[model samples]
Target: MKYFRVDLITATPNPQRCIYVGMHQDYSESFVGENRINWPDEKKAGEICVKRLLAGERGHYGPMEHVQIVFNIGWFPHSVMQQARTHRIGVSFDVQSMRYTGNRINQVAKGLLDIEEVFYLRPIGHYVDRKGRRYNYTQTQRNIDLQYCEQAAKRYYDLIEDGFAEEHARGILPFDYRQHFIVSFTLRGLLHFLDLRSKRDAQLEIRELCRLIWPHLENWAPEFAAWYQQKRLYKARLAP
Candidate 1:
């Protein structure tokens, strides 16, 4: 199984500056001119922006929409990507098409070669039980699952080689098959995504993905990230 990857491609040139500009739109009268307003102290501006966001001030979140972050993610299971696409507002995605890539199994005259090397997500349930106890799949069960996947891959290859279109052949692929995509999201949308997907109750795969991505976001906006961590606002909806 291949490890999931999330690569930060790019982000807003000056995230804090963008937020400050939006804040200034509401408080323009407070400054004499654009030159008079604090121009380059992003740390200080980020601090003020974080304050407003934490305090529930009007228009604070609206400014976050201007700061965008982009990522190139890959080798994650298809099910996780499908779930991720539900965050349609303020986010964009360009996913790899199975119709174009086809099933990527290696074939040999004897049988499927490198079947053990095929990328698939390990079943988390095999390692941990519902109560968080360590659990191991019986060897019999493990072999059955592996054989099933190998047979499926073989059938996929056979279908493609026998004149089936790539799109039709992809129907045999499992949800655990690895996939890739490029995705972008505004700061506000990203925060919303983390708030929902990073929770303890979220699917293990996506929760892990969010945890891996969180540190990079924190590095980009320390003040706001601190506020988010301290407040635990991600669980606010679960509160009574």
Candidate 2:
């Protein structure tokens, strides 16, 4: 099986301080809640900012004090779930979860695979063949083990339904069960996260997600976005 690595970095601070560079056409000082708003027209300002960012203008935002961002990390059951949920109370995220209501944790049982294809049958062979020698093969033992784990989960869930303490019953669930969570970060926090998570050393899942998000931020908050990219480059050079 392929190990899954996921990372999520949130924006630092809150939106209260950061002046959103874009969204001027429809955005106003009132929209962002600024009493001493200064501009010819909120609509015109927003329009111009959005246009410029989309056109690739990057610089220092009005003030870095107001912007904040957060991220939701996704991966296998045990990997990022715990960390994500932990960040939920402290940070904010944009992912869905089953933790709110008492519900069954999602499950997608799979053994380690030589390739990325999904298979639903038992395979009988050594785990891996190397130099004409097979190793790590316990022959069907791995499958049997996972099956037993699934069964145990089902039994524990039933027990909980029958009045057993859920806290204890839940102990039986394995780490691979899929979970979801939310995390909130400010613009500053996001920059910090990206500085670490968006680099070549970052995990694949987080890095891919960063690639998807950076462009959007570049459009939404041009100055702040540009600052993040620059910060990332500087930090990378410092990595030994």
Best by TM-score: 1
Structural RMSD, model 2: 9.8
Candidate 2 lDDT for residue 106:
19
- Identify the runs in model 2 with alpha carbons over 4 angstroms from their true place: 1-17, 20-63, 70-76, 81-90, 93-102, 106-149, 208-212, 230-240
Candidate 2, residue 42: the lDDT equals 34
Maximum-lDDT candidate: 1
How far off is residue 140 in model 2, in Å? Answer: 8.1
C-alpha lDDT of residue 80 in model 1: 80
Question: What digit string (tens of lDDT, one per residue) describes model 1 on residues 1-240?
Answer: 246788999998768877877877776765524564556477887887877755553435788888889998887778888888875446898887888865465352126555434546455345655678887767677668778877778788888879999888878766577778898988888877877788876778888788778987888777777777776545733211
Instruction: Please report, as a residue range, the 10-residue window in candidate 2 with the lowest summed lDDT.
Output: 113-122
- TM-score, each model? 0.84, 0.48
Cα lDDT of model 2 by residue, 1-240, tens digit: 233333445443323223443234234545444443554343444345434432343533333325555444444344444443332223455543333422443122222322112111223444433345546536477677666665655666576668877566666755444444455554444555555556675444445555655765665455545544554443542211
Lowest summed lDDT across 10 adjacent residues in model 1 is found at 106-115
RMSD of each: 3.7, 9.8
**lDDT score for candidate 2 against the true structure:** 0.45
